[model samples]
Target chain A: MIIGGGSVGLMISYYLLKKGVKSIVIERKYPGSGNTYKCATGIRASFTSKEHIALMKRSIELWSELRDELGVFYERSGYLWLLSREEDLRTFKTYVSFQNELGIPTKIIDLSEVKCLAPTIVIKDLLAAVYDPLAGKASPFDLILQSWRLLVEKGCKVLAGVEAKKILLSKKGILGVETSAGFIESSTVVLATAYDTVKLLEPLNISVPIEPVPKHAFITEAYRDLFKPLIIDWTTSSYIVQTPHGNFLVGSEIPERPSDKLLNRLEFLRKASKVWTKYFPWMKEAYLLRYWTGYYDMTPDHHPIIGPLDDLEGLYIAAGFSGHGFMMSPSVGEVIADWIAEGRPRVPEALNLSMSRFKKGKLIKEIAVFG
Target chain B: MDSEKVIVCRCEDVLLSDVLRAIERGYRDLESIKRLLRVGMGSCQGRHCLPIIARVLAKTTGLRIDELNYPSSRPPLMPIQLKYFVSDGNEG
Candidate 1:
């Protein structure tokens, strides 16, 4: 049984069913009604860390394979990080070399190439950009729909609007989850509950240090595609992308308190617009169509916790993705299914993301997190 | 008015037939329907579309319209420009 019916949980069920392993997914709300829907929609393997680059590289491969199967319109439009500061240029130059060495075709493009890629962008004070042609954007809604449809066809049980209140455990081993409705009897339980994973496990004396941080994004009215790739102002950690649907989706990180509520702030709008308009002055005329918020299931080192709780015999976890869960779900689901069915995750790097690392002081930091 | 031609969400150009099709496709909730067909997500922000959609949902799902919780409304309850938030000497 899987607790939390977000993209991660649903994808896990998808792979598990493919592996001939039958599992049930119970969600407090509808699937993709959470962070999966509110994500920046950018997928990339451009990272400073070897662990992230490797996993995301594998994930991008899986995304391509699953695109047709899931029937999602995935546009490999690429990602361009606009560097306005000298330090950022030096940093990205090193990152580009590192990413290229890791088999990801990420390179530093000059200002002239940047203009060719993102024509309407204002490149004043811009040095260069780190471009990853393999990175792209796709509709999370379509992914959710397709996954849900596949699960239905597979005859897999997915109960929506049912909340998992507690992880019912016995001293011997696993007992199942005590949900809002009743007790579900299952020995092997996977907690993909995001930040709420902490809450459900607290009763069982298992502590996963995942914090729910509020993040926001907004989209503009549909228009002609002005840019081909998702552009990020690296200095401010703000990004803008003209989606295939022709809406320019924009988001940024700003100072705000972490709250469970999906609260919208005028401050976020002001800060995000200032940075977006500074880079794409043409966007000033674009009407901000819709704005919304969601939580980033953050961990200490900004990497996800994926693997088993050694203390419990049949318990597993795949949460604390920080902000990249949606993009990483495909590979994560496959490996996690392998772990449950075939004894361990196929990828050795995935073992590093287990909860035990927090206690072992083995933290792999991912520095390329965008707002 | 014919369900096929009646305009339900003018902001997104969604028709009454579109909402019915979504409901037929297993999107029984307002949020799911909105996401699937872009209903109640236009400049009016569902000010006009939601009530009608809710009633349609109620008629089909056999649940009262009030039983259907409206999707959350974010800031700029009405359509407002981004510049307005950053405008100098302007009190919001």
Candidate 2:
């Protein structure tokens, strides 16, 4: 059984089905109603760590294959990380070398080259940018919708509107889950329930080091495409990308608030607009369409908690993606399914993501996280 | 209503047929259909298309419109120009 029907859960279900393993996905709400739909939809493999780069590099390959199989457009428009500080440039120079060694084609481009790639950008204070041609965005809507359709067609069941209340345990290890509907008898269960994964595992005394850090994002009305690449200002953590549908998606980190209410603030609009206009003054002409808030399923180390729990024989976790869950879903699904089926993850790097890493203080210190 | 000619979401140019097709494809709820076909995501923000789609869904799925999960709505009921929100040297 897979709990949580977001991209991670759905992708896990998809791969499990592909392996000829019958699995049931239990969701409290409808699929894609969670963080999947709320994401900024940026996909990239460029990172500071070898583990993240390797995993996401594999994810990008899977995403390409999924495009043809699922009949959805995985837009490879690429990503450009704008570095304003010299230290950030130096840091990314080392990161690019590591990424290149790992077979990811990422390069540091100067201001003139950056301008050539994105003409609308104001080349004023920017030092340099790391460009990843392989990185881009995908439609979360179609991905989930298509996955659901295919899963059902393949005779796999996805029980929507049913909440997994608790994972039922026996002395032997796994009994199944006691849900809102009733009890499901499954020997193996994967918790992909984002921050809610903590609540379910709490009763079992499995302390998941995950926090739901809320963030805001908004999009403008369909406008003329000004830039192709998803451009991020490194210093400000501000990002803007024109979607394939022509809407300019703009998002930036918001200041910490006392309350974690999922509400859009007027201050977010002011701050994000300030960053956008600073880089591209033409963005001031754009009309605000919609603004919403979603939480990042953050872990202590910023890396996701994947792999099985040592205490529970049949329990596995694939949650705590920080903010990159949607982008990493493809590879995560493949890895988790392999771990479940074969009792080991196909990739060696996935072993580093187990929940026990927190107990051992072996946190994967990831620096490429968005605020 | 001729589903092809009948437009449900005017902002996104979604037809009644489009919504019907989404429903036929098993997107039973308003939220799923909204994301699948962009049914209610537009300048109007589902204010106009939601009721129509809900009625359509209710009629087709045999579930009450109230029973189906409605998509969440937020502020700025209408699309607002960004110039209107420009800071006037007050915000520090």
Candidate 3:
């Protein structure tokens, strides 16, 4: 049984169906109604860790094959991580070295190359950039629809609007899960509810160190053929990408606050507009279309926690993607399924994403590009 | 016409008076009013009521018609039944 029908849960359902394992996905709301649809959809393999690089590398390969294999639409428009300081440049160089060691085609480019890649960028304070040609973007909604169709065709059950109320566990282990509608008997239960995973696991007394942080993004009125690659300025904590519809999607981090209100904050809009106007003076005249918000299931180390719980049998977790879950879903789902079924994976370090790391006080910190 | 005004979004009730009240609250912006009253967040997603609400807000707030901002467009763009999505188009 899978709780939450976002990208991760949907991908997990798809892989399970492919492996001929019977599964049912229960979503409190409709599928893709969570953070999955609100994602910026940028895909990349540039990470300092070998595990992240390998997982993202596999994800990119699967994204490349998605159109041909799953009949989905994906565009490899490339990604550019812009740097504005010497320290950022050094970090990019180190990340590029690690990515290269993992057989990922990533390299540090000069300012001139950055201009050539994205002509709209103002390169006055820009120092260097990490370019990954294989990195790109995909449509989260389309991917979910296609995956749902495939799952239905393979005779899998997807229960929408059915909230999983509790995970029923016996001395033997997880016997089943109770939902708003009825109870589902399953030997294995995977929690992929993103920010809601904590509340969902509370009944089982499984505490995950994941907190939901609000992230906001806005779109501008479409400009024909302006920006080429998805631009990430590590210094400013901002990124922008031109959508297929011609509108530019812009996002940035904001100070954390506790609120259930999903509405866009006025302060965020003012700050985001200032950042955009300063970086790309051309957008000063462009009208801001609309703004939306989503929560990031953040972990202290900024990496996702996958695999089974040490205390409980037949209980699995796949949350804490921070902001990268949408892009990394395809590969994560497959790796997790392999680990669950075969007791190993094509990439071994993913199994090391155990819950015991937190207990052992072993935390791995990465260069948080978004934070 | 006053009695004909309907409260579409239950989370906010958002009667025509509430919209005018938002304008009196110094919210000359349509997006601001929508955010305050949730006028466009019902199951219809403002499909049937946006233009009327915009006109009312404009007339009541004494703002020019073109000065009002458009409400945010959510995806799925249409109101889809949850059962239709899950049950392969066999509506419940």
Candidate 4:
């Protein structure tokens, strides 16, 4: 049984079905109605760590074959990480070298090259950029819907609008899950519930480092061929990508605030617009379309917690994705399923993703600006 | 009724009577009224409805209009068909 039918849960459900494991997904709200649907849908392989790079490589492969494997729309629009400082340029160059070693083709391009790559980008202060033609975007809602249909076809049950109140555990192991509507008997249970994981696991005394922080994004009125590629500027923690529809999908990190309120703060809009204008002056004239906020389940290391809990025998976790779960869901799902079915994951290093790190006080430190 | 006066969000179609009813319901803040009636979740996404909703909410709640916060915006800015979104073309 899977609690929370967001991208991770839904993807794991599909993979489990493919492996002939019957499963049921219980969601408090509708599937894809949570943080998954609110994602910026950025798929990128630019990471400072080996594990993240490998995970993203696997995810990118799956995404490329999604149309054939799952019959979903996946695009390869590429991503460009803009750097304005010498230190950032050096860091990106080191990362590019590591990526090249892993057979991931990433190039460190000059400002002129960056202009050629994305003409709409304001190249005045751009020192260098790491360009990966493999990175792109996809719709999380569509992917969830398609996966849900496939799960139904495979005879798996999905209960939407039903909340999993508690995990039924005995001395033997997890008996099943108790939901608002009823109970289901299962030996295995996975919590893929994103931001709510911390709250949900409070009863069990599992202290996850995850906190729900607000992130906001906006779209500009459609402009004719304004920008290409997902442009991420590290200085501002701002990312902008022109959708196929010609509207610029833009987002930036907001100052941390209390999590319960879903209201859009005007201060965030002003800050985001300022960043946009700094990056692309031409965008100043673009009409503001709409803005929305979503919760980011941030971890101390800015990496996701993906493995099982030592205290709970049958309860596994795939939450605390920081802000990058949407891009990593495909690989995370496959890895978790392999671990559950085969008794060990094909990626042995993924076992390090267990909650023991937090208990042992071993925090993985990386230079992540947006988390 | 004037075309501009049409209420799109049925939950908060603030007739004068509805305002009095909200006051009777003991709502004393614009935010409280919006929460109760969902005055801001329509297709216009609160763009055309919020000013009026705020006014009614303020009058009924016995609060200054400036005290009321603006309603938030939701995503999909302009809702398009799923097919159009999934298709590999540049049209929106």
Please provide TM-scores, in order, for all candidate models, with all chains considered together: 0.95, 0.97, 0.79, 0.79
lDDT over C-alpha atoms for residue A280 of model 1: 72
lDDT of 3: 0.75
- In candidate 3, stretches whose alpha carbon ends up further than 4 angstroms from where it belongs are A257-263, B1-92
State which candidate has the highest TM-score.
Answer: 2
What's the C-alpha lDDT at position A253 in model 4?
Answer: 72
Native-referenced TM-scores of chain A, all candidate models: 0.97, 0.97, 0.94, 0.94
Among all windows of 10 consecutive residues in model 3 chain A, the one with the lowest summed lDDT is: A258-267
Residue-level lDDT of model 2, residues A1-371, one tens digit each, is 99999999999999998899978998888998889999888899987777788789899999999999997668888999999899998899888888899888999999999998889889899889989999999988888989998998899999899999888888899999999999999999999999998899899887888888889888888976767888898898888888778888888887764237787799888888888877877777777888888899888888999999998898899999999999999999999999988988887899999999998888888888874
Candidate topping DockQ: 2
Decreasing DockQ order of the candidates: 2, 1, 4, 3
Q: Score the docking of each candidate (DockQ).
A: 0.54, 0.68, 0.03, 0.08
Deviation from native of the Cα of residue A134 in model 4, angstroms: 2.4
Q: A296-321, model 3: which lDDT tens digit per residue?
A: 88887888888888888888888989
Error of 1 at B56 (Å): 1.3
**lDDT tens string, model 4, B1-92?**
55345553553354555545655644444433453454554345566667776776666566677666454456556643222322246633
On DockQ, the stronger of 3 and 4 is 4
Residue A3, candidate 4: how far off, in angstroms?
0.6
lDDT ranking from best candidate downward: 2, 1, 3, 4
- List, residue by residue over A154-252, the lDDT tens digit for candidate 1: 788888788998777777888888888899999999988898889888877878899988888998878887788888888887888887778888888
lDDT of 2 by residue, B1-92 (tens): 79899999998999999988888888899988888788777888899999999999999999987678998887667787665566575632
* Higher-lDDT candidate of 3 and 4: 3
lDDT tens readout by residue for model 1, B1-92: 79999999998899999988887877777877787787777778888999999999999999776556568777666666666655674533
Is candidate 2 or 4 superior in TM-score? Answer: 2
Candidate 4: regions farther than 4 A off: A257-260, A369-371, B1-92
